[model samples]
Target chain A: MNAVRRRALLAVPVAAAVARDVAAQPAVEEDFAAAERAILAGRTPVAGGIAIDMPQLSENGNSVDLAIKVESAMTATDHVTAIHILAEKNPVPRVARFALSPRAGRAEVATRIRLATTQTILVLAETSTGQVHRASRDVIVILGACVDGG
Target chain B: MIGRPAAALLACAALGTLAAASEIRPSRDFLSPELRAQQDDPSRHPGWLWVEEGEALWRRGEASCQSCHGDIAGMAGVAARYPAVAADGVLLNLEGRIERCRTQHQAQRAFGYESEPLLSLTAAVALRSRGMPVSVAVDGPAAPFVEAGRRFYETRQGQLNLACTQCHDENAGRRLRGDVISNGLGTGYPAYRLEWNALGSLHRRLRACSLGVRATQFDFGSPEYLALELYLASRANGLPIEAPGLRR
Candidate 1:
C-alpha cells in the first residue's frame, strides 16, 4: 500500500508541485502597497503636481488606458514634478512615471497599461511647493466579459 | 432606403459580416520574425531616445514607473490589444478603462484618462511590444463600440476643423504645417509627438482635432473619446505595431 501511494504522489502534476513549492502569488503587486505608503507618509516627490485618470470599470481587464496631469504654472519656480501610474493587480505594481519640468510645457503624460484584474491605480505628483497632490479612481472589472452582449 | 430597423440589419447582414471580417484581421501577420526584429531589438534600435528617456524615468522611484511595471516583457504580449471594450459592456480605452484598479484595489489614484503622463507610459509600454501587429478583439457587445468608433472616424470635429478623412484619406503623405501626414495610421502611438514635447495618446490626438476645429476639448474619458479610440485602433489594422513610436 505504501509503495502504491508513493508512486501516485511522485506522479503528481508538475504544476501542483510548483504551486506548493513557491510562496502563493499575491493577486496584486507589492510596491503597490509600498508606493502608497511612501506618498501618504508625507514625503514629497522632488517635483510636485500630479493627476490620475482612468475608467470606472475595465470590462476586459487586460489593456487599460491611463493618463496623468500635474497642475503647474510651467514656471521655473512652480513646475510640475512628476506623474506616476501605479496599479494593484498587475504582476508589477507601478506601471510608469514621467518627470516633468517647465520645458515640458504641460505637467502631464498619456499612456496605456495592462491591468491583470480590476484594482486601484494611483497617480502621485510632487510640486515645487513641497506638497504632494494625488488623485485616485476605482476601476470595476467584470469577469467573463458579457459587455459586448454577444 | 427606409425599412424596419431589424429588417434593414438582416438585409445588410452579409455586408456587416464582411465589414466585421475585414475590420478585425490585419493584412500582415502581427508577430512575423522580421517585424519583431525591427520592433524590440535594442541594438538595432531605431530610436534610443525614447528608451533612454524611459529608462531614466524608470529609476526615479518610490514613485517611478518601474515601481509598478518592472521589466515590461515579463508581463508578456498583452499590450497588443487594448482600448478594447470591457466584459461589463463599457467601452474603455487604455486610459478610462481601469477604474477598479486605481482606487479600490491599489489604493491609488488612477492615471488621468488620456492625459500626457498616461501617454508617455502607455507609449513606453507599447514600445516594448515593438513588432507585434496591432490586434483588438471585436467581440462582446463590442459591435456597437466598433460602429460608434467608425462613425466618429468619418464625422467632422473641430473649427479650422477637419475629419480624419481630410488628411488621412485625401491628403495622406502631404505636409500639414510642415509635417508629413502619414495615412493617419494608428500603427505608432503613445508616439513621441514633437508638438506635444512628450508622447501622446490617440484620444489626446483626437483632442488636438477638436482644438483644430476650435471645439471644446472633450472631458477626458468621455464616450466621444472612447469611440474615436476604437475607430483609430481599427484603422491601424494591418500596420505593424510601432508603439511608443517616435514621431516628428
Candidate 2:
C-alpha cells in the first residue's frame, strides 16, 4: 500500500479501534473444573482471591502475554504464596507454576505464553492462608492469519 | 588397496552424515500464488496493515523501533545473519532482538509476540534486508542453536497434535480452508499482512501458528523462540531477506 492509501485507511481511528478490539477477543474454555482438577491433582479448590487478565480476543495463539496479580498484604497472614497458570483446553493443562514470598513485594509475575487455540486461561492464586482466588480469560486465534508475510 | 575396513566404515558414516547435513531443501510453497506474488509490490492494491506499519516504522521508526539501527541504508545485511548470540551470549531472532532494542533504546515496554508493534517492527527490519541472501553462520555456538531450532520445528505440540512441518513441508501449496499453505518459510517477514492490514515479524507469524495448533506459546525472548529462529535462518540460507515485505 502506498503512503497516501494507508493514510486514508487509518484516518478513521474509530473503525480501526473497533476492528482491533474485535480481533483480540479471548477464547472460551469449555471445561475449567476438569482442567483445575488435573493441575491441582489432589489439591483443594479455594475461594475469592485470584484474577486473570486475559484479552477478550487474541488474533494469534503464540506468545499471548499473561499476567496474574493477586490482592495481598505481603504480611505472613495474607501474602500470596504461589500462583498457578492453566490452559483449560491445551493438552497440558498446566502452563506455569510460580512460587512467591512476601519479599516479592507484590503478587504479580508476567510472561508471554503460546495458546494452543481459542480456550480459557485460568489463574489460581494461593494466599499465605492457603486461601485461593481464581480468574479466567477467553482467548481466540484467527485461523489462517498466522503467517502474514511479504 | 586393502584399507582398514573398520576405519573405512567409520569414515563412510561420517561422510554420509556430512552429506545429509549439507543437503538443501526446496523453498516452502508460499501462500496462494496471488498472495505470494503481491508480497513485494509496495504499490500493490489492497495492502496488509502490518506491512504498512513496517514501512512506516522503517523510514520513521515506530516508538518500539526508534533509532535502533542508528544509520539506515548504512547497516546493510544486518537482518540476514540474525538469531546471532548477543553480547550476553544469549541467542535472539530478529523479533527478539527488536524487542531488546525496543526496551533498551526506546525505554518502552516490549510488545507480546502477537502485538502489532512486535510484528510491524520485525517487518520493518525485514524490509531493510530485502534482497540480501540469508547467510547466518552456523559455525561454533551457532550450530548447536540451529540444531535446537530444527528439533523445535519438527516437534509436535498441544492437543491439536501438529508439527510445523506437517503442513509446511509435506503439504506446501496445499489449500486449507480458503487459503493456500505456503512452505513454512520465514524469508519475508516484518511482512505486510492483508488479513491484519499491517506489517509483522516472522515471530508473530510463528506464534500465530502455535496458537492454531493449540500449543502454549513461549515468550518473545525465550530460548525456544530463538532456537526456532536459528532454524528459520538456516532454512532460508539462500533466499533473499525481504523484511517488512507484504503478505496475506
Candidate 3:
C-alpha cells in the first residue's frame, strides 16, 4: 500500500474511538439552558439554608440517591411547600417534585434519582412564604443514565 | 523474654485474634457516619419506599401473600436463614424464595429482579428478620452449595482478573476511587444503593462489581449469582440482618 494510504488506514481505528467518545457525551448545554430558563422564568433563587446531600462522584447514573433539607419552622407559616429536582444534563431536566406540609414535621426529603451525565443537579425549594431557595451539586457519573441494565 | 503470666496473656491474645479473624461483621460497620445514621432511621431510609409498596401489594393482590401467611409477623427472623437448601436441593436466597412463592403459590407473575415491586417485596420480607443474626445452614445437604459459593469467591475473572476478596476482603474499608469498599456481605440486601438511586438486589450489586472489573456479568437469578450470594451470606453468618439498607 502507498505510505499515505497506510497512514490513513492506521488512523481509522483512532478516529472511530474518538468519534465514539464524542457521541457518548451528547450536547447537554442546550438541554441544561432550556431547563434552567423554564424553571427560573424570572425569579432569581437565593442560595441559602438549603442542603443537597448526594455523592460527589456517582459510579452509575441510573440511580443516585438525593436528600434535600430546607431550614424551616414547620409551623403554619415559614415552611417549605414544594421542592423541585432538576438534572441539567438529563433528557428531561425535571427529575422529581416533592410537596411538603407542616405535618411532614421536618422539611427533609430523601429519594433516588436518575442522572444522564456528569453535570450539576439543581434543587429548588419554595416556602409557604414567598421565599425561594436553591442548591446545586456537581456529580461525575461513570455510567450515564438510561442504560440497559442487562 | 516475657514472664510466665505475660506469656500466657500473649497466648490468649493470639487466640482472640484468631477467633476474630473467623468472625464477620455487618456492612453497617463500614458505612460512613452519615450513611449509617440514615440506614438506622426508618423515615429517612429510601428503602422503606419499596417496603411500603411491598406491604401494599401483599395486602391488596388477589392472591395475596397475606392469604397464605397471615400476620406478616410470622415472617420474623425468616430472612436470617436464607440462601437455604430448597426441597429439590437448589440453593435459594430471599429474592429467589419470593420468586418461587409468587410463581408456585400465588400463581401470579413474578416481579422482575431489581424491579420496584420485587425490591419492595423482598425488602418487606427481609425487614421481618431485621436485627436477627444470619444463620444459613452450611452443613449436611447445604455443604456442597456453600463450597461452590466459596470457590466462586476465590476464583478471579474478567480482564482485571481480580477475585472478590482482592478488593472486598483484602482492601475493605479502603477507598476504591471515591467509595469505600466494604466486606462482601449479604445481610443488607434489597438495599437502596445511592449509586443506583433505587432499591436493588444483592445480585445487581454483584453484577456491578463484575462489570467494574470488566468481567462477564452473570444474568440475574443465574446459578452463579446464587452461589456468590450464598458465599457472601456465609461470610456474614453472625452479622445481624439489615435489609432495606442504605448504602452510598
- DockQ values, each candidate: 0.01, 0.06, 0.13
- Evaluate fnat for each of the predicted models and list the values in order: 0.00, 0.13, 0.11
If the candidates were sorted by their TM-score against the true structure, best first, what order would they fall in?
A: 3, 2, 1
Report the lDDT tens digits of candidate 1 across residue range B1-248.
11123223432565754454343333122222332443455553344556565456444546444566676554344455666766687776555543444555456576676544455455555666667655665544656776787777677765545676676666655554323455555666665443343556665666655654556678667887777676665555434577755443
Q: Write the per-residue lDDT of candidate 2 for residues B185-233, one digit (tens) a residue.
A: 6776656555454555566667667666767767656788778877777
Better of 1 and 2 by TM-score: 2
DockQ of candidate 2? 0.06
TM-scores of chain A across candidates: 0.66, 0.67, 0.72
Off by over 4 Å in 3: A1-150, B1-23, B112-115
Each candidate's TM vs. the true structure?
0.47, 0.51, 0.68
Worst 10 residues of 3 chain A by lDDT: A1-10
- Name the TM-score of candidate 2: 0.51
Q: What is the interface RMSD of each candidate, in Å?
A: 22.4, 11.1, 9.0
lDDT of 3 at B241: 90
lDDT of 3 by residue, B1-248 (tens): 11223323433656863364364557999876767887999977878998899888778777788988996778897888888888898888888888899999988788877778788888998999898877776565666776788788888988879898787777877775446677879788989876455788888878877766667889988888898887677667667899989876
Q: Between prediction 2 and prediction 3, which has the larger DockQ?
A: 3
Quality of candidate 3 docking, DockQ:
0.13
Best candidate, DockQ-wise? 3
